[model samples]
Target chain A: MRRTPPEKPADYLPIAFPAAMLGLFFVVPFAIMVAISFFERVQGGFYQPAFTLANYGRFLSAFFGEILVFSLFLAALVSAVCLVLGVPFTYLLTKLSRRVQVAWLIGLLGVLSLSEVIIGFAWSTLLSRTAGISNLFVALGLMQQPRAWTPGFAAVMTGLVYQAFPYTVLVLYPAFSRLDPSLGEAARTLGASPLRAFLTVIVPALRKTLIATFIIVFIFALGAYLLPQILGRPQHWTLSVLVTDQAIYQSNMPFAAAMAVFLVIASLVLVLLANMINRREPAS
Target chain B: MSGRFLSRVFFAALALFLALPLVVIAGVALNEKKTLAFPPQGLSADWYLQIFTDDAWRAALVHSVLIAASSALISVAIAAPLAWFLWRRVAPWARIVQVLGLSPFILPPVITALGALSFWATIGLYGQPWTVVISHGIFFVSLPLVTITLGFATIDREIIEAGTTMGADDRTLLKTIVFPLIRPYLISGFAFAFVLSLNEYIVAYMTIGFTLETIPIKIFNALRYGYTPTMASVSVFFVLVAVTVFGLVARFGDLPKLLGAWDEGER
Candidate 1:
């Protein structure tokens, strides 16, 4: 049961600042962005407020279609990789002592808050020829010689996965930490093997969270603007990278706004779906 | 037993994987040559020194700090009241307001960045540093909003009742009680927004373009031309700042609680 606070004249006072700021900045900008998406792009690095579908029509082109498909595929791969690795890691993290868990949490937070630019630079160096791990492999006679592995698809995937891994763990942390340990113990007592107990108990228990986590990570990866540009070839560029390029380099504001509008709607739909799944799950 | 051993190995490998890039970057930062290389021919602190001494790098660092600090203040300013209002008053519209506060972060940052870009352009405030500051402040308000809300929830209702019985009004009680209690949450929230704003690239880039060079924008520009050990040094510096900030948060704050881990005492 919930009790509503009594309506007071002063109640509106505290909310005034937030409403003004968000309304003026966030709401207004997004509205403008949407409106601009419908405008026509003119020559000489400008656009007009005239009605035109040509911007949205660009989406039908093979170039835009290919980029969209690649973006979706790459995002799916990043999310799947994060989920596969993050779930078991988070589960194991819960099994650790409190002090160890805090340390791990700190590490995760540190990585999570780090700028994408730094991560991209770090990965670029790590995957570079002169200082790359391939050199270590060569030293151990596992490979013929050192070679750079970046400026390609694998580099982009690795960077995105690394970037997303911490987020996945953080989102799953609350649920896993709150999970009832007795359920697993009971399964074990019923002659289930350890892996079987985990499969039958833990995985099913967190199914909703897993689904939501998958979609959330999917959304995050889809909007990776920096990593793909830094690590991947042009063909591997995600829609986000292309959006920045078009908006900045190509100076095509209308087309860029249209693409961004599409990205926002897709992300919005996925987020709503995740929320729906989460709401469906009974409160712990 | 094998399963346990293998799992341990996997976890170790994952940890190594996470640390490897940072370690490599640190090594590259210490290299003698200007090239981004490990196993340096000789050690040199020149690149690290260069971050402070060089004009472009130094200006970007200072600019990033300025934006981060002011934006963090603005974030707390916007979030504190809204969260306080929600805690003190529970209207139906409270949920809508809360959602609005969080919306900037929930969507992809690129969307938010584009929106800010167009808005600034429309208002003829494009290419202004203040625009980036405000955009970042608004963008990261969700951080402090969540933290301060958590702070308010931890305040026991009985305390408010006791204060009222003592004839303390809303203003006095808030000043004496609520403000003192939520100070740590406020600090943590500020710290979060500051560090993130410092690290943010896209919003800052889109709003102000190259007119104002933050560290990320500077790094991206440098990366476009070529790699340098100086970039690695800056990367190392950033990692240190992130680690130190988060390490303090872990030490002084209820980090697990902040992260939404279930109460241990309850279990």
Candidate 2:
């Protein structure tokens, strides 16, 4: 059956409703944020209407620079860890029976539903001196005493990685499941060891997916606000924590907006890059 | 094979790592003491009872439910029409709309929250519950958009032609054909958005703050000021809620398809 494309009048209602909603709520606000970043910070925790580059200039400080660098590093680390752990787990997942796979997928979805705040505190309790892994170690005679591990980098990383691991698996699962098992079989028929066949065949095949997963997880970890604040010390606070601190607590909306603009730009670039990679290999 | 054994061991250990914190929280929620402990001094449901009976926790629970329900409705309302239009006609403007709609979610919540803060303040809507509702609706519209798009993909073109041959208008076709076929996706999308909004924190904090206390914010404050078994109990409540919602989606809908794990093209 030949069908005609819907005409202009018909298109107006569908396009206009969502467009208006997004424009007013999403795009315009971002524009306003960018505009506010240029406004002057004035007395009494308010900003003046006068245009200035003062907020962006404040980002030039070494302290803000350190925070931004540390955030990128932390996000990179989390993404790397998720990829390292997720790839093998997903590989094993694809090898499972269909029913078992569904069960595990549902379990991962349930974990993914947990809010960062909840995960952070859950890990904090798990890492606390009173009833943490250290206590288990002591019970096993592996340690002399329980140790307080919260408000530290390791604890923060654990929380962030736990929050991100599900995402990494979900993202990679579709690609891995779609892969032909015969590819590995074909390699093994040529006398390649199982490890060698996997490394040489599957690893190369999922290269783009691996990079995409890394960037996705990296961006997610970069935007983390509650986790770092809950699980780590002041020095470990990410760029997100600083943005909220400056905006709400410090009452420096302009500076906060400026930092936020920077954060958005960084995220935007990574997302666009990922999109491009996905486009380049649409099948993957 | 050694490789198979290694994979099994590695997967088991990682799964345990993922489940450990949740298991510990559930254990601690049964503590008889105020302080959190794993080998709880004594097992009791006092913390759970406290969550159910305490005024602050009860109010927060109610508020969270209200906000999540409203936001999920708004998201599906917006996403349904948008998905319908895009599926019917692949207009250039539709591509732009799709990007704009989904970008809020792709970008960090902090950025969107900052934008919402500035925009709401400018329009004098700050500290209002509706601001958070609208913000969350925009943030999570992507979930329904993706689901509904997949739903639309499943409709055979011939079915649309058949409806047209019967002289059914677009609205009639949608009501008679599209809605019924896409109903599960719509429900799944709603459940997805509801669960996510329940878990959302930064945007809620930035937009509504103390003006309205949602569960996440309440739990966050509790954790920051001090650790308590009450907070652990709240976390348990959240886990249970998430499981229940997703469980329904899995039971009634195609969870793998909703997750985009199953390719229609392949079939």
Evaluated with lDDT, which candidate comes out highest?
1
- lDDT by residue (tens digit), candidate 2, B50-111: 88799988898888889999999988988998888888875765788898878877777899
- Which residue runs of candidate 1 sit more than 4 Å off their true CA positions? A1-6
TM-scores for the candidates = 0.97, 0.97
Tens digits of lDDT, candidate 2, A1-284: 34346676855787678888988889999999999999988878888777899888878899988998899999999999999889878887887876787788878888898888899888988899988888899999999999999989998999999998998898898888888788889998999997888789988888888887789889988988888988999999999999999999999999999999999889989998987777777573
lDDT of 1 by residue, B4-33 (tens): 897789889988989999999888889887
Question: Candidate 1 — what's its lDDT?
Answer: 0.89
What ranges in model 2 sit over 4 Å off?
A1-5, A282-284, B263-267
Q: What is candidate 1's CAPRI-style docking category based on DockQ?
A: medium
As a TM-score, model 2 comes out at: 0.97
Among all windows of ten consecutive residues in candidate 1 chain B, which has the lowest summed lDDT?
B32-41
Model 2 CA lDDT for position A85: 88
